[model samples]
Target chain A: MREKSGSRVSLRAMALLLCALIGASPVVAQELTTSLVDIHQGSPLSDRARGLGNGGYELQSGNRVSFNQWYRASWVDMHVDLLTQITEDAGILWGFGTGEQGEKYRIEPSLKLGFLTQMHPSPNSTLSLSLTTTIGGKLTEKSCQADYGDLGTYSVNCRLAASQMAPEETLKYLVNAKPESQHLWLNYRVTF
Target chain B: MPARHLKFGIATAFAMLSAPIASAQEAPDADEMAALCHGGLSICVSATIPAARTQAATTPGWMSPDVGAAWAAGYKGKGATITIVDDFSSTSRFSGNFGIGVQTQRHGEWTREEASMIAPLATIRSKDFTTSSSVTLAPGLNVLNLSYGMYATAGYSPNQIGWSAEEASIISYATRGSAIVSKAAGNDSVAVGGVTNGQQDYLDLALVGKASAIFVGALSTNGTTTNKAQLAWYSNYAGSNPLVQSHFLVVGVDGSKTDLYGTSFAAPIISGYAAIIGSKFTKATPTQITNDLLNTARTDTLVNYNASVYGKGEASLSRALAPVAIR
Candidate 1:
């Protein structure tokens, strides 16, 4: 079975090579394109990575309380994150943020690539469209979730939910969402 | 739990064009073979983009649904349900324009349309999995499609947190007869992790685990003909992950025309195929389906393509579903 699979993979490699040999330009190497860099502030992972409930939920008095809008959870809050480019266009963009109580920090690192509609001679004044997709993981500090008034009165102890990576939960939070959890995004930016 | 299912079918017209020898083994009758081959040829050639285009049409290419229509596996996936998890705004104008297996844009939405066009008959669902989670894994959803990833920060290395709960949930899905497909983000991470790509810890960790997961990298879609295939300039390379050593796959996706670039889009193409396979063999475990797809991929479009970037080469739905001869 392993050998058959190996042969199958080899076959695919050969096909792609043939496509390149027959269809690609050989006179000269393809010109290098500029890599893209940007800053994004969003949660890439859902509650899967939170630790087993133990810590207290940090609530700020009179502060805006945000619901996931999709998951119907009262713990939704926004964080400010920064992603920087490491190479000419390609690089790593990551940020660290805490929950409302400022006791929890989530680690987010995104592998990002950017595409611009057009390149302008004026590096500073060019207006371009950027499309970037970042694939990485998120880790949360071991903190506890306290039942807040927003969640209504519940006797069940809500110690910090165990921190784990749940692909399904993460996806569900994004799909059934009203505003915050949507996954695909497109933004326009200026070089200045 | 890991029972390997073996299937063998004669090469379809599409397969024969690239592997003539394989076709000869199955179709001894030249006339029948010619008809099959002709049909495929027609589909492949006909799928080409017409010469006319507005300035809006950049990097034009299309897959001919007709070429392998007869010879290609007719499985549009009978029972499997695929869930694509992304962060598109729920109120975006892209929703009502949704259609399976055909390309049309109501607004900025493209993937949902593309997925439906690829497998119009499959039971498909889309959701947003991006939220504040202490745990990355959702409790009990099958075949979750998470095509997004984080960049890998100093506090959290790649191998340690990159797989976290999301990776665990994928395993959970596989154990229950469903699979997950993740797109390898397209940024070149040479600076962070040296040569291959970025987030060595994360990509490496995910690759080594024996879970029923797939990491699809990207390929350029701007060739004039089928031969001009090349890895996207920004596709990441796998550093050293034992699991990833043999479990990578690449598939073609035209992100240039839409905002859907990166392995983010590539993962769904694989998910669509998985949906078809799962629907067909309802009893098969996720591991079996995962192995079958890997075993059946057509690597022709990624010659010399980095194993880290292309992974087993471009995916082929027709070949993956090749039937086992009754005789």
Candidate 2:
């Protein structure tokens, strides 16, 4: 029995090692274009991205990278675009006495389907419109904090009660929450 | 009775039982095992001991329902080591009879057994504090099970409780976040720092504010999803110090099941739980594992849960094990 149990443990350890190796491997993809952009309203990356009333006015800046593939459909031209953006060191402020305030980083990856039409009225002018859908969720490490002054100072690190730490809001969501945003985005662009 | 007297008694009994055997055989028959526990030896024998031995013979070890889910989920403390710091006779005596079904009547022996039962795959090491106060921590994830207390005469202040090498090593480890230290909140029926019966356990005072130290209290029975549990009548409480309360946790002792009672039995459960949590979160620091257990403890499972009384309430192994990231 001891031998069997030892063998089972060895097998599990090997499996865990394989999983770690796979998870640690870097993701590789072709890069097309990179640009810095700031969202003034309704950014799909932030948790507070509902609207102006819900603090959507908070400016979010990130480096946006676009990957594109072009194809000709019967009459008009078409292109599939992949937009990837990363918001680095974004501040996550907590309400009074709610938790320890901190910062988080997020990455938003989206796909866009669009059509292109040439205009004869203007030389070398083109019009394009695309439906962009963004997909993202909690992508940062979880943390716990408490105000040692407001809550009585405790000997333990992170003195607040577990409920006060809001683990369900911070840690649980990392495991069980769905994509943060999945709304249709309409964009029109004029290029020369 | 002095510890030396008990040690001599146990050694003599074992010698008598082993005299007829030429080679190592199956653990002494049940009748012989029972005889070893006769007279003052009842401390080693309980109604559950024989049954537990029978069960251990067939299975790896006994696990309480509270930690059963973690075991089923392949987190049976495979990568962790639990160093039990208690009195398990002398070094030579313990080394001679430290294996499955080899029961002894020492405080540390039962504590070791309890911890192994909870995390069957966890590496368990004995540091007989009676012989030496120095504890050498094992590599990898470590949980220090201190089911025994270092006490002083009544009215001794925290500063006056001369710290031993063992205490210093444990405090240093806990302060440095090197290991999770699970200490038994003495069975004095008073607050954690309260004095009882002419002595005070200063180990509790020294551990306060340490990064990964936890004071474990006992509940009368196990709490389940449907039923809530209550603090054992003799268990020490968290008291008014929020710092102490923040690091305190309570687990069921279930004397009827283990045939042993007191905060001593409660500490091993938490130690085992820490090891199980470490098994899952292999990358988690000792402090992270400590916070994971404290942050995920269940208040609703304890009747009229009060932080001052129950500390962090009943430790929920399932809740602690639920999180993918233990920060």
Best by TM-score: 2
- Candidate 2 local Cα displacement, residue B157, angstroms: 3.4
Q: Which regions of candidate 1 are displaced past 4 Å?
A: A1-192, B1-61, B64-74, B90-109, B132-141, B154-168, B174-178, B189-204, B222-228, B240-242, B256-259, B305-309, B323-326
Listed models, DockQ each? 0.01, 0.01
Label model 1 with its docking quality class.
incorrect
For model 1 the local lDDT of residue A73 reads 24
What is the CA-based DockQ of model 1?
0.01
Clashes of each: 99, 3
For candidate 2 chain A, the 10 contiguous residues with the lowest summed lDDT are A51-60
Off by over 4 Å in 2: A1-192, B1-63, B90-104, B324-327
Interface RMSD of each: 25.6, 24.3
Residue range B229-260, candidate 1, lDDT tens digits: 66655555544554563566666545444434
TM-score of each: 0.42, 0.51
Please estimate how well model 1 matches the true structure, expressed as its whole-model Cα lDDT.
0.37
